[model samples]
Target: MDSIDLEVLHACDQWLRAGWRCEYVTVVRTWGSSPRPEGATMAIRADGVVVGSVSGGCIEDDLIAAVRENGIVRTAPEVITYGISADEAHRFGLPCGGTIQLVVEPLGAHSRMDELLALAQRRVLTRRTLDLTTGAVELAQGQADEQLRMDGQALVTIHGPRLRMLIIGAGQLSQFLAQIAVGLEYQVTVCDPREEYRASWSLPGVEVVHAMPDDLVLEMKLDSRSAVIALTHDPKLDDLALMEALKTDAFYVGAIGSRANNARRRERLREFDLTEDQIAKLHGPIGLYIGSKTPYEIAVSILAELTAVKNGVALPAQMSVEHGKALAA
Candidate 1:
């Protein structure tokens, strides 16, 4: 599954190629609590077909109505604001009287959307700059830490893989996790040195590597945007990979196992050079407590925890399998 941004870009690409007039709308800024972030985007064809979203369904309806009425006749880009008043906020369904600023650009040859889409498909971090007056665009390599910025003359939006996940083991659980993670826009890679497991693995879009987990983890240079999950249930594979992963800035490092096994794993890690703080970062038994008994359900539980961490949501102690089990004891 494509990310929301990718979906919009792809819809624009198709509409443009089909000779349909289209307008690209991006959220440039927002005040108070908005449903979507500043860089969220959507594209509308002249026929009122919309892909992606801005302020959920409310703002999208307005944009679609505008496109149907005016047909995106503007030759240049323009900035528009919505929900400026309490009544307007209520009408637009913005929570807490939120305000949202948008950049509505009529698509044309100068958009350079093809180049942007290609870069995004390649998972390359790209900075796209759009001139507000001329509608001309410029593309350059972007840093992971770069953010969306708008000056009086232009809008610069960063595109590419903002998150990644490395799954240690191409087993059934990894397959389900990779599928969901892809929809979440994670550049997923599943590493398994075992040939038998690697041969049967057939998920598309996820990279399958036949290398040691530890070496793969180091090679990827795991950063804050990265996550590592061990599902192999093999000490030789998971322990080595986690040893290196915990030392890095990967936002989450987890291994699927029982609470007692996790404790044992920590003890074994202490046998190595890992410190207590680093060891504490490990998420063992690895998922939220949702009474998951099947592989797919377990994958959902794991992703729920991963998503909570990614969004910086604080999960109640009883929500976690390990913590809940402990509390029950």
Candidate 2:
């Protein structure tokens, strides 16, 4: 599935190609408890059709009403702010008197949206800079760590996957996990050397490779924005990847197993060249303990913990499988 931002871009491209006036709106800044974070986008056609969101509903409603009445009359990009006052905050439905700043750009040939869409579809990280004084846009290669920035002259936005996930197995659990990860806008790759498993693995938008997990881990050169998950439950396959993954800067490295198996796995990792902190980075027993039994439920549980870690949310010990189960016992 395409991300909301990508979908907005696609809609803008289609609208422009169809000879319809459209405007691309982006949330550049937010204050207090805003509904959406910076970089959230929406595309509005002259007929008041929209494909994405900037706030809960009130903001979109106002934008749509304006477009329907004024018919996208703007010829150049303009910045607008909402919810700056207490009454305005309540009117826009911004919680806690939140304020949001947006740049609404009139889409045309000079927008370079088609090129941005093409690059985004190919999963190429791109930085799109839009001149505030003029409608001209420039596209360049962007790093994974780049964030959206706006100054007096231009607004720069980063597109494509900013996070990646490497699953060390192509099993049923991995299939579910990979699907969810893709929907979360993560570039997901599954590596398994076993022919029997890899032969049947087929998922669109996810790259599957027939290589040893450990070798693939080394090849990826995982960074802090990357995650590694081992669901094969085979020590030979999972352990090999875990050892290499733990040594990298991957923010999350987890394996699926029981408490006893995870303990044994940790003990085994001590024999490797990994440091104590690196070994401690491994998240075994894989997921938050939500009493998940089926593969789909387990996948949800795993993603919950992964998301928490990614967002820097420190989940309580009782939320883990090992700790929760032990408390129950």
Candidate 3:
């Protein structure tokens, strides 16, 4: 789960503890353009206050009004569908026939929210299975490949940050990358063996480690959901990390440099035990062709590529900065 969903859960727990009634609303399915994705959650109190979002603003507003006017009287979980017809779609402010299905469960004793929050805080991915009939929740360990699913009888939602990132630098670019990665709900760790860089690294939510990049990569046991981005521009620090990262199931391995520099880096990696296929996986001159110059812009460009890779979207060669510049020249 991302930070927003976590916040909603925390709010629900607090409200329940305070003797206030609130209903937890989750998007189970969406059709057409949706402001929020499936598994997105919102907690609405009886007084119309809310945490998180379902359909940007309009759907949330409708939810608040309904809760305030009728009260959260549901003893069991219920599925609600919005934007069924063209008129209803316009009334709900849904874009062009967009429809959303939600599961709303009133806060009660069988919620098991405290355990779920604790598991999430521990960085453990958990599967929360909710029985729609009895409003009973069951918690269990979830795999990285699992996703949210709802059958006729129950709804299962995966909670916790499934994406992990190993940033091989603690410099300015890494600072922006790590901060944004945190907002994107990536469990980020910055590894810089140098004392000077490690001393000044002070990002609050990210973990800063004083270990060799390769050693950290080995210890992390990176999997398919993991990403490794080298921003130090130091071969000694970045190359070994790339070597280990390329050998793993990591979905993305990138390095920041010019095209020529990356070419040289690839030649250098050839001297290692890496096979040609593994070496081909390196994404140097990383990020999309946005002509980004500032640290934040560069970070955004980098994440744009990462997000594309994560979503399995392919960008053509002409879209790359180097290729575009060459064509222009």
Candidate 4:
């Protein structure tokens, strides 16, 4: 499972390449209340096929109808608003009389949709610029500020960064962990150089890498939105990667271990010339203290904690195994 945004973009690219006319709808902005966020997208093919979503299913039907009846194929890239009033909200099934703004553009034919999709497929962040005048699209590689504009449109759309996750082991636990991570909008990779563990590893969409963990970390070039999790408890496998991770802006760096082991691990990292600031970024005893007894339960606990941290929630020390260790005896 690739990230949702990636999957959607991929589907859009595939639809375009199939020689079918496609409408790419992106939610640029909303007011009052909306089912989806500003960056939400939905792609519709000529046969009324839809992948992804902007508003709820109700709004999608209307868009499909427009594509089929009103010759929306010729509409070009334009901003459209819907459900701004109470009556309109009920008609469109938008909860709380909310308003949604959609920027609909055609796929294929000299547009940068395929290029942007390819960039995202390769785990690269590319910005797409839309010409409000002639409905032209250009893919911007490298770094530049995002810009959006639509001709007499309701919202400006800017496709943002892609999501990424690095799973530092190829084990049963890593398999479950990778699936959950992938479902939650992450481009997941499972890394393990040990052939014994690597031989059993099989995941459909996840990238499996056989490399030294630390070297792989360096090669990944993880950024702030990226995450690294060490499911392998061996210091030889996990420690060097974690040491490199803590030094980077990767938002989350965690390793699975017991309380005392995590403490010892931190002390071991201290010997590596890691400063207090760098060490502080490590998240060991890695899952929420949910008393998980099975791999599935443990995966849930880890994912829950990851989401909390991703959303900027402060983690409580009481959830650490150190706080609950007295009972584990």
lDDT per residue as tens, model 4, 2-77:
5557667888888777888887888877888888887788888888888888877889989888777855455567
> What are the per-model numbers of colliding residue pairs?
0, 0, 1, 0
Candidate 2: where is the Cα deviation over 4 Å? 17-19, 85-91, 121-124, 138-146, 191-211, 218-223, 270-277, 291-294, 316-318
* lDDT, residue 218, candidate 4: 95
Best by the TM-score measure: 3
CA-lDDT, candidates in order? 0.91, 0.92, 0.90, 0.80
TM-score per candidate: 0.80, 0.82, 0.88, 0.85
Against the true structure, candidate 3 reaches a TM-score of 0.88
Q: After superposition, which runs of candidate 3 have C-alpha atoms over 4 Å from their true positions?
A: 198-204
Question: Mind giving the per-residue lDDT tens digits that candidate 1 earns over 30-138?
Answer: 9998989989999989989999889869999998887788777889999999889999999899986699999999997789887888888877889999999899999
Per-residue CA lDDT of candidate 3, range 81-119, in tens?
Answer: 998999988988888879999999987769988788888
Query: Lowest-lDDT window of 10 residues in candidate 4?
Result: 149-158
Off by more than 4 A, model 1: 14-20, 170-172, 192-212, 215-223, 247-249, 270-280, 289-297, 313-321
Q: Which stretches of candidate 4 lie over 4 Å from their true place?
A: 108-110, 141-161, 316-329
Per-residue lDDT value at 14 in model 1? 84
Minimum summed lDDT over a 10-residue window in model 3 is located at 320-329
Q: Candidate 3, overall lDDT?
A: 0.90
> In terms of lDDT, which candidate is strongest?
2
